[model samples]
Target: MTNPVKGPTGRVPGWVKVVGSVVLLLAVLFAGLRLSVLPGLKDLFGTETRDRSGPALLESIQDISRYEAASGNFQVVVDLEKDAKFLPDAVRGSRTLYVGAGTVDAYVDLGALDGDDVRVDDDRTSATLRLPHARLGTPALDPERSYAVSKQRGLLDRLGDLFSDNPHSEQAVQKLAVRHIGDAAKESGLTGRAESNTTEMLENLLRSLGFKEVRVTYGD
Candidate 1:
């Protein structure tokens, strides 16, 4: 989604044509991206998204890693794909099923579950989910132990690389989003298509996992 063209667009100035073309290409890419996810991404368009089903437990949802939604609060957004309340589900907070995306420094929160043999890299950038001779239980989650499964293949994670032409593949989407939107990547910037679409993807990921209150700030 990083369509970093040199300038702006139009019959007005020197950079307009270049910028305009980039904008258009980005737009097309974004449109195609939107189409790819279509109904799937609807829950996370401008705001957030949520899916409310039965007391569906994480119930052996193995591999819940890679995309970590940073420590934050929740907001509610209706699903663009469905007539149901999307983002709010996360806030409701009962039995839950969440999908999130983040840096995933690859650490396991032993404090959260049954885990042991804690280890860290020299850079403290990655960690693993281990169990102290205990196994996983379904419907009946044992607060004492279980592996923090982390896998990369969420809808957004998959969609992020759709047609990105990105060197880092789809995963680059997150880095790109965070980098571009950093501190100043808020408020004014939501004009370009690819970038905007990327924004959509990020928002969708958060909402799916229940981070409904995602404040998006885009950049040119």
Candidate 2:
């Protein structure tokens, strides 16, 4: 009988092993690049190195009502103009007209209240409460409605603006317009009106709570 022929054992070739190593190295490098660029990828893949939500988680459950009070909204329109001159009037640089529409808030804070500020008359028939005075908050300019009504820039003005740190001079003018709106709202008795409205509101609320008489006053 002829000797049985031996078949070659099945095994991966050396070239195949080298190719597999290169592919694995490339895959590891690509993964490292992605992880470096996208820090959130680690969290998405459940490989976050550390927890960073401690403070945010704690703040999420805290109450925010301890700092607020009654607020009233007032709409105001402010017209303002500013002129910057590099030379004589003949060489006027820029004259800008800004029209700003702002919403001003007037608030009455109750955070300063104490037990003595609220007094109940004998027999509990009436209650008198003294509250802090109403004050005006900053005016929030409406980006949609507030804009540069007109801007006239002379040759020098345009030339200087090209190199100035603040290229847009209208922005500063718009800020001034907003400030004027807040000032105008305050001067228009807006805060006093807010105080009156707040007092009336609180009086009605207290009356609804079975108080025969409710007197609400504001302190200086």
Q: Every model's Cα RMSD, please?
A: 27.8, 17.1
Put down candidate 1 lDDT per residue, 54-138, tens digits, no spaces. 6856656565532221222111111111112454422321221122122211111223343234444455444433322211111
Clash totals for all candidate models: 21, 0
Task: Give the lowest summed-lDDT range of ten residues in model 2.
Answer: 63-72
User: How many pairs in model 1 have backbone atoms within 3 A of each other, for residues 3 or more apart or on separate chains, i.e. clashes?
Assistant: 21
Model 2: how large is the Cα RMSD against the reference? 17.1
Tens digits of per-residue lDDT, candidate 2, 1-220, equal: 4333322445556777788899999999999889878978866767547767756444356432222233434444444434564565335556666667767767787767889999997787799998888887777877787677677766776787789998775677767777777677767787787788788888888888889989888786
TM-score of model 2 vs. true structure? 0.59
Residue 188, model 1: Cα distance from true site in angstroms: 62
Please report, as a residue range, the 10-residue window in candidate 1 with the lowest summed lDDT: 73-82
What would you estimate as the lDDT of candidate 1? Answer: 0.37
TM-score of each: 0.16, 0.59
* Poorly placed runs, candidate 1 (over 4 Å): 1-12, 40-220
